[model samples]
Target: YRVHLEHYMTELLDLTVAAFDYESKTPTYLLTQFLSGIDWSVGTVNLISSIDLKSDKRITILKALTLLAGECKGELDFLENRVVDLKSQIGSNTQLHLRYDKNCDYIEKISDTSQLCTRLYCYGRDSLTIESVNEGIEYLDSAYINNYKYRKEKTIYTNIEVASDLKTYAEAYLAIYELPFLTYKVNLADLAKREIWQHEIINLGDTLRIYDDDLSLNVKVRVKKITKDYVSENIYLEFVNYLYLPKFDNIAEEVAYLSEVISNIVSYDDPTKVSVDAIDDLPTIL
Candidate 1:
C-alpha cells in the first residue's frame, strides 16, 4: 500500500523533490533543506527590516551603493567634506570682481572708426627732379554681411622688421610666440559640434566655465574670440585670461602668500577702484 503525503510535504513544506526521493532520503534531506532555508530567510528578513523601505530612503541607499561601487576610492561623506574644504580655501584665496557697463554702442562706434580707410602719402624726387607720390590705404567694408547664407571672414598678416631701430617690435614678436594664447589650442571635441555658431550660443563678455580633463581643473573664463570652420563643422572658442578652480588643500593659502609677496607692487587704494576685500573674508560662526 502507498500513502501520499501530498499537501504536507509538497505544499506546506515547499519540497522540490518527488515523493519517491523524499521517502528514500527521509529525515536527513528534510532537515538539511529546512535549516538552510530558514537561515537565509531569517537573515534576509532582518536586513530588510533594518532599512527603511520608503522611496526617498531607498534612493539614498542606492546612491550610497553606487558611490561605493564607483572607481573613486573614498567615502562619500569624506569626499563631500573635502569638497567643502576646497571651496572654503578658494573663497579665501581669490578675489573675482566683475563690472558691467552699457558700452556696446560705444565699442561698435570705436570699431567702425578704427576700420575706416586711412591714407598715407610719402613724397620723393625722381632723377629728373619730378615729384612722385606713394600712397597706402586700408579699410574694412562698411556693408559687410554676416549670416547663414553669407559669412564674411578675413585673415590679418603683419610683418615687423627686426632692425636696430625696431627693438620693441622684435621683443613683441618673440613675446607673442611665447604666449599661451598663441600656443594653446582650445579644441574641446565634445563641445565642438553644435547646431549654431558660438556667438549665437553666447554673446560677447559672457562668462564661461571650462573644464580641462587632462589637468582635472575648472577655469572661469570670458568669451573673447570664436572661430568657426564651416566645412569641417568645428567651432573653436577662445577665452580671455581665466581663474583656475581651487584644487589642492593648500592652494588658497599659497595664493594668499603669493599675493602678500607682491602686495607692495599692487595697490587698490585708488578712489575709483572697487573694493573686493570682503570677497575672501570668511563668515563668522554663530
Candidate 2:
C-alpha cells in the first residue's frame, strides 16, 4: 500500500499577500489573519500567545509563516483531515544521536561557505543611511574579518527607514552571512525499520544529533527538508544548522517544481468526461 502523498503545507509558497499591516498583536492573531488572507482552512494558531508582533509590509505567506515560526521556535504539523497545528518548542533538548557506526544507511555532510560575508552595505528608504553605533553605509563583522584575514562584502536593500532599525537589520543580515551554511543529507529508511529506531515518525524541525567519527564532528541540527517516495516507502531527510538563513525557494528549485507540476497536468479535450473533483485538482492554465 502506498502511503506517502501530498500535504497542505506544500501550498504555502504559492500563496501571496499584496500588503498586510498589524501592530502589537499576538502571533496567534497574526497567523490567523495570514491563513484567512490566503483562504487556507486547515491551520490552527494556538502557539506563542505571549509574544506580540508589529509589522507593516507586503510579504509572501510562506515568508510570513517563517517569521512567525522563528519568533515562536515552532513548527507546523499536518494532522488528520487537512488540519495544520502550530506547535511551540517542538524539538526536544534530549538529542537523538545518529552515527555511521551505529548502522545508519547513508550520510553526506556539507558545509557551504559561498554565502559567507564579513561586511554588508545596506541602503534603506530614500537614501536613509545607518548612522548609529556602527555608522557609515556599511556594517562590518570585525571578528569575522580578523579571523579570515580579509573581508567579503555584499550589498543589501531594505524598506526600513529609521536609523536604529536599519542598523539592527544590517547586523542581522551580516550575522547570517558571517557563518558557513552547514547541512547533512541522510537516508535512514533502513534504520527506521529497526525496532529500536521505530518509535515515531520523524517530521520537520525535529532536533537531531549527528556524529561522524572519521571527521570528528558532532553537532545538533534541525530537520530542514523531507523527501519521500510513495512507491518504495523510502524517506530522505536534510538537516541544517541555520533554519531561517537559507530560503526554501530559489530559482533552480522553483523551475524544477514548475516543470514537475506542468508534467502532472492531465489534459482532456472533452470537459464532460472529467469529474468535478478532478477538475478542481487541475491548476488554472492561462
Candidate number of the best lDDT = 2
Runs of candidate 2 with Cα error greater than 4 angstroms are 1-5, 8-44, 48-75, 88-94, 122-142, 146-150, 156-173, 190-192, 229-234, 243-286
Per-residue accuracy of model 2 over 144-205 as CA lDDT, tens digit each: 57667668878877666666666655654554456677778887654566687675457666
Which ten-residue region of model 1 has the weakest summed lDDT?
102-111
Candidate 1 lDDT over 179-242, as tens digits, reads: 1221122533323134442223443334444444444434444545445555544445555531
RMSD of 1: 31.0
lDDT of each: 0.26, 0.61
> What value of lDDT does candidate 1 attain over all alpha carbons?
0.26
| Top-scoring candidate (TM-score) | 2
TM-score of 2: 0.54
Backbone clash count, each prediction separately: 0, 0
